[model samples]
Every structure is written in structure tokens, then in C-alpha cells.
Target: MIACDNLTKRFGHFTAVDHVSFAVAKGSIFGFLGPNGSGKSTVIRMLCGLLSPSDGHARIAGFDVAREPAAIKPLIGYMSQKFSLYDELTAHENLNFYGRLYGLRGAALRRRYDELVGLTHLAPYLNRRAALLSGGWRQRLAMACSLIHQPSVLFLDEPTAGIDPVARRELWDLLFEFSSQGMTLFVTTHYMDEAERCSQVGYIHLSKLVVCGEPDDLKQLPVVNPPDTRRIDVTCEHVTVGLQAVRQLPGVRTATVFGQSMHLLVEASLSEDFIRTELARVNIPHADIRPIAPSLEDVFVALTNNRNGET
Candidate 1:
């Protein structure tokens, strides 16, 4: 339902989105990921007809991004990172305004408003002003407004940014509901766990698409494990301090704190006894240290490092 054929975009002398290409199947939730300024948003704009690509093009719901930019707008929905839904208006009023802007009138507008309210479960907050609603409620309101036109394809750029964890999960539930109904969802997020929920994921780096595939396939990539190296998850007290201590040890290629645990990409020859000995020497209290599966974050870290020649 969505395709990018060598999509390229430029601004003045700077190339924003390089010749990136990927396809999204119908009813699938595709995750777009990258560091800041990696052209994730640039590619979204080009696909949504908000920006013109300097070279190549994209298609949404079978409409050419370059030739039929206008035609594509009506076929897709876009909810930007900072949603511009009116703050002074109530949730219902905001949807009503957007519904009208999308050319729904009278009976059609009312029907869509009801459908969106039911779909997003915004009925309880319908009369509440957007500014008065909580972060989660506001996000749902923005999502409803974006879908006021009932577009088949939805583009969400950092939709869960700055929201609480519970709110993020709630929003993802809605995304899953949309995908189950045959609506194509393209979402960009920095949260690794959120990317895991996507059926397909595309990783962008330095304005180029470095890798694109299913989460399991990405996790199993040889680039992640490399040669003579393995990954281990170590849960230790004082996680921040433990990270500092563990990173200074030999054979530890990469050490990062994840929640209450620490992930280390270390030399496989480093024995568990050796790690325990080293941590104990520094008085860093640890619960358990064991080899573990590579997570999505590990895959991206390895892929990005390899792509940038970081070894």
C-alpha cells in the first residue's frame, strides 16, 4: 500500500534524504527509526506530499508522490510530532473542524465524528478542551482529528515522544487496532520496545536507509554478533555506577545500562568468572550475569556502528 522508489530529497546544498527505498504492506505497522537529522521526517514529508523530492519519488495507496502529490493527500493521514490540533477547542470541536476541512459536511461529518470518537475512545473526553486534556488524551484527540478524513494510510512521526510509558502503550494499542482493520501505519520512534511491536522496521543512518526488515531478522543479523564477540545482560545494583565500572574492563566492547540491567558486548573469551571477578574487585554489587539474546537496540547499535566504520 506504500512504496518508496529511490526516494531522495535535498535542501540547498545539503542532502536530507538520500536515495532511500522501502515498501510497506497493507495492514502492516512499519517502524521507521534513526538518530536525529537522519531524514526520517524528510522522507515522511516527501511521501505525504508536504515536500518535493529533488530526485526519485514515493507512492501512497498507489498514487505517485511526484506526479500526483495532490491526489495522495486525500488517501493518507499525517499526525506530525507536534500535532497542530486547536488547543482552545474541545476534542469534539477539533475533530469537527478537521472533519469540515476534509470536506465532510452535515450527516457525513457527524458520522465520522462518532466513528472516530468510538475508534479512539475519546467520547468521555469529547467535551473537554484540548489544552485541558492529559497528554494521552491529547494524543488520542490528535489521532482522531488526523483520521477525520478516514484515510487508509497513516503517517505518525514520533507519535509517542514525551508521553508517559502507560500513555505510550495505550497509543500503541490504538495503532495495533488500526493495523488489524487493514489500515497501513508508518510510525517513527526512538523507543526500541515500540519498534519491536512493528511487523516491519527500517533503520536510517546519516540520511541513508542502512537496514530494513522484520524485527527477528534484524536481531539475527550477523553484523550484530560479529566474530569473537558475544552479548550479555548483567543485572547489578547501582546500574549507572555499574555501567561506568564495567565499561572500563578489558574485552568489554560496549557497555550500556538498560533499565535495571546492563548490556555488554564483550569478547566471547571473557569468562563469566572473569566478569564477576572484575565487578567484585570494584565493589559493584551485581545480582546475576549471563549471556542473553540480542535485543533490537543491540542490532541497531551494531548496524549503525558498522555502517559508520566504528567497528
Candidate 2:
């Protein structure tokens, strides 16, 4: 249960979060996405009661963020992009420390630590120093420490950054497990795939919330792809060099590299044959060119481009 009522935050003359408003239902994962400096972390700080809002307000689990900052602190757990755990401390030691900070001790502390160890698959790394653990394992240790107090809500800012794909998936599994248990999770991520997994998503752009909705709803938004345009996926050689050349093609709306392939938003009237000819003209070799569904990235990109046009 989280609610924001026109929340705004400013620093000197610059506004970091601009009149943002959204509600996150209980037992759901709300993904926050934006480019760097888009105020994603700023909003999270205000919601967590770590940073005061310049105008308006937010309530975390019914507690007013500005009025009850202290009460809000114990009800939520926050993990940032970097590992907050001590590099010299072992996984178990980190958990024990945080547990003690939360006033947990004796049998209760031991039990909570044990539960986290198992839940995060940290039993094998219980004695491993945080510095020695891989990026993913270190993040897992940080997560276990954050949950030492069993907060009702969790705020993760770029939690999967710099971690491998497998590790990122594993982390999401744990987050989903938390959601199933009625824990409210607010996560900020750049990975479109991770955003797709969220029950709800809010896209922030230029310090404003541009769009917030279910993944499918956002994809289906008419603003994402114009009526006269459609996206095509192409697996081509020399992808790095082809991107520049492809963008210059007539009737090509936009072209961006997607993993090992390229996603081109082209005029709908342009046939696949025309696209092939254009690529051939530029000496860009490709094996396949086909239409695909709008992805989460597509929604955000369109929203961003539209926002730019409006301004």
C-alpha cells in the first residue's frame, strides 16, 4: 500500500522530481524506469522518508512520508545500486549486524539470519567475505541484510545493475516470492526485460512521470507506434556500423540495436522488399527482417520521443 499525491522535490533551482503521482497496490511489484537524472532515485528517497519532498506528499503503508519519517523507516527496507554491506564482513556477519541494528538478537536473530541465508541461497557463502563474493552474490548478501528486520515494503534502486543475466533473473525470482507473500516492492531498473516482469510500471522522463500502466497497456498505447508506422526486427551482419547507415534510410522512422539484432521502426507502407533493397544499397547484410510485437522499451522510447516533441 503506497500512494503519492503530486509529490515534488527540488534542489536549489533544479527540480529533481516534478509533481509525480502514483499508487502501488499491496503485494505487487511497481517498476520505476527512466534515463539517468530522470529523478527515479529522487522519488524513491522521498517515498522512503530519506529525503523530504519540496511540495505535495506521499504515504507509505498509510504513514505520511513527511509527517512520520521515523515510523516509515522501520516499515520499509531500501537497497541501492551499490552494495552497502561491509566488504570485510562475511554474509552471516553482515546479516547479524543488521539484525542487531533492528534490535533482533539471541534466538530471534539467529532464526531470521538463517531464514535469509536459505531464501537468498547464501548458505554456501555465509562465511565468505563480501569483497570476495561475485557481483551477484554480493548483491544477494546486501538484500539479505536489508530484510533482516522483515520490513513490509522493499525499495530497490537499480538492484540488478552490473549483474549477469542469470543472477538478475534469480534476484527477480526472489522479488516475486516476496510479492506472493504480500510484500510491497518498489523497484527501479533500466533493463526492459526486468521492467516487463513488473506487475505495474511507471516511466519517468525529464523529472516527470510520463506514463504509468501495465506492460501490455503501455505497449498498446496508440502513442507508442503511429498508425502509419510499425517495427521490424532484423538480424544483420556488421550491426555496429549498420545502425548509422540504417537510420539514414528513407521511410525509416527509427532504428536501434536490440541485443544481437536491430529493431527498426519504419513506415508501414514500406514493404519488406524495400527494406531489403535499402539495406543492400548500404551494404548492410541481413538474414531476416520481420515485424514483432511492441516491447516495454518500445513504449518508453515512444513516450520519451513524444515528450520531446511536446516541449
Candidate 3:
């Protein structure tokens, strides 16, 4: 439902999105991941018709984004990062306002309002002012307002940014529900776990798209799963100490502390016994070590480091 061919955006001498291109199949959830100021938002703005591309082009459902923005607008809904809402208006009033803004009125407006309220479970806070709602509730309200017109595609820019864990999970649940109903979703997120949930993902850095594919496929990329290398996880006390020790080992390519464990990339010849002995030297004995697969974060880290010519 979405396609971009060498989409480029420039501001004077600076390029924000450089020759970026990707496609999103209908009913699929495409996660766009990148660091701050990496041009993720710039691409979204260009695709949404809010900003004109300096070169190349993008299309939504076969309609040229730059030339037929009006036609595309009716086919897509956008929920920005800020949860755009009228602070003084109650949830119910806000919904009505957006519904009218989309040209819904009378019976039609009432029906969509009810559907959104039920979907977002905002009925309890219908009379509550937007400013009075909590972050989670405010996000739901924003999502409901975005869906007031029932567009086929939804663009969410970090939809779970400031909410609690429970709220984040709940928001994703709604996204899954939407995708199941054949609604295409384009989401930008900083969370690795959220990216894993997407049907396909694109990682952008330094205004360039580094990689784009399914999570498993990206993990299998040779850049990530290097030849003659094996990934392992070590669960032990003083993980930082274990990490430091393992980093100095000859065959250990990368060692990073993850929670109470350490994830390491090492040569296949680097046996677990060798790692255990190294940990023992640092008084971190009795470690539980096991082989593991590369995670989405690992894939991006490997690709980013490779791009920067780092070992």
C-alpha cells in the first residue's frame, strides 16, 4: 500500500533523507527505527504530504504523494508523537471536533465517535478534559481522534513514547487489532522490542537507510552473523566485570552487558570452558553460559558499526 523510490529530502545544502526507499504491504505493520535527528520524521512528513521532497518520489496506494496529497490524505490517518489534542476540550468534545473536521456530521459523526470511544475505551473519560487525562489515556484519545475517519492506513510516530510499560503493551495490542482488520500501519519507534513486533522493519541512520527486512532476515544478514563467529549469553553476577574480562579475550569480537547477563560475539573456537575460566579469574565463577541468536539490536549495532568502519 506504500512505496517510495529513491525518496530524497534536502534543506539547502543538508540532506535529511538520502535516496531512501522501501515498501509497505497492505495490512502489514512496518516499523521505522532510528536515532534522534536521523531523518525518520522527515521521511514520514514527506510521505504524509506535510513536506515536499526535494527529489525522487513516493506514492500511497498508487497516488503520487507530491502530486496527489489530497487523495492520499483521505486514505491515511496520522497520530503524531505529541498526541495532538486540544487541552481545554473534553475527550468527547475533541472526538466530535475531529470528526467534524473530517466532514462527518449528525448520524455519521455519532457512529464513528461511538466506535472510536469503544475501541479506545475512552467512554469512561469522555467528559474529562484532555489536559486532565494521564499520558496513557491521552494517547488513547489521540489515537481515537486519528481514527475518527477510519482511514485504511495509520502512521504512528513513537506512539508509546512517554507512557508506562503497561500502556505501551496496551497500545501495541490496539495496533495488532488494527492490522488484523487489514489496516496498514507505519510506526516509528526507539524501542528494539517494538521493532521486533513489526512484520517488516527499516533502520535509518545518518540520513540513510542502513537495512530493511523482517527481524529474522536482518539477523541472518552476513554483517550481523559473521562467518566463524558464534553469539552467546552469560548469566552471572557482576555482568559488567564479566563483560570487561571477555572483551580483552583474543577471539571475543564484542561484549555488551545486558541486564544481569552479558551478550558476547566470539569465534566458534572460543569454547564456553575458556569463557568460564576467564570469568573465574575475575571471581565471577559459576556463570551460566549458553549459545544464543542475534537480536534486532545486535543486527543494527553490527550494521551501524560496519557503516562507520568500526571493527
Best by lDDT: 3
Residue-wise C-alpha lDDT for candidate 1, range 1-311, written one tens digit per residue: 99898999889889999999999999999999999999999999888888888998688878898888778878889999987778889988899999988899999999888888887888889899898998888888899999989889999999999899988988999899889999999999999999999999999998999999999999888898878998999987788877787788888999878899999999989888878777777787455988898999999888888877862
Residue-wise C-alpha lDDT for candidate 3, range 163-256, written one tens digit per residue:
9999999999999999999999999999999999999999999999999999989999999999999999999998887788889999999887
Q: Candidate 1 vs candidate 2: which has greater lDDT?
A: 2
- For model 3, the superposed segments whose C-alpha errors exceed 4 Å read none
Candidate 1 Cα misplacement greater than 4 A, ranges: 285-287
Tell me model 3's lDDT, rounded to 2 decimals. Answer: 0.94
| Pairs in steric clash, model 2 | none
Clashes (candidate 3): 0
* Per-prediction TM-score: 0.94, 0.94, 0.98
Candidate 2 lDDT over 1-311, as tens digits, reads: 89999999999999999999999999999999999999999999888887999999899989999999888888899998797889888877888899998899899998888888889888888888888999999999999888889999999999999999999999999999999999999999998889999999999998999999899999989898789999999888887677787788788888889887898888888788877777677787564888998899988888888889899
